[model samples]
Target: MYGVFPYNNVMATTVSRTSQKTARIDIRLTSEQRELIERAAALTGSTLTQWTAQQLMEAAQRDIETRARLALESEAFDAFQAALEEPLPDEAQQLLARSPQWA
Candidate 1:
């Protein structure tokens, strides 16, 4: 359940996302998937390509964010590690202790 907070690393600061139609990528999807995407695109009033691109960008952002690592000051690091190492609450410990019996 620990969140890997971001470190001080950053990608190049691009002034803006490219908007020119300068590249092409092809993706294959099952009929059902394509239908679902089409429906979603219709709902958002965007073309299939536009909707797909937006969805891809959003997913990529989430993926990168999750993989980010924490870079904390020494004091902050000590505090964070201290918090993580604290014991689970009694009720949670009790529930975990009983989990094996459920199986």
Candidate 2:
């Protein structure tokens, strides 16, 4: 089933190393997609597995960092800071004066 792509030109860039790899991930792709990735890997002197793993890791890190950050414009940031500096309303102050009723 994997006959169409030429695999002879790909080379492993890194020296032989061993690690405890206990997890497995399975994915399905079209032959064209596989061939494209294989070509890219060969050009970068990386094994297909290594190139794919690195790409996945970089993409995941970017996604996580983007989600974790809160970006605000300068005017909005000033408004937010001003709100924090304001005192609580009278009703809120009264609520804080009461003792907690624990069951």
Tens digits of lDDT, candidate 2, 1-103: 5554444323222222334466777789999999999999999999999899889999999999999999899999999999999999999999999888972
lDDT of 1 by residue, 4-53 (tens): 43441222223234444778899899999999999999999999999999
lDDT scores of the candidates, listed in order: 0.84, 0.84
Q: How good is model 2 by TM-score?
A: 0.68
Where does the lowest 10-residue lDDT sum fall in candidate 2? 8-17
lDDT of 1 at 40: 100
Clashing pairs in 2: none
Error of 1 at 21 (Å): 1.5
Which residues of candidate 1, in runs, are more than 4 Å off? 1-18, 71-76, 79-103
Please list the Cα RMSD from the true structure of every candidate, rounded to 1 decimal place. 18.4, 12.0
Each prediction's TM-score versus the true structure: 0.51, 0.68
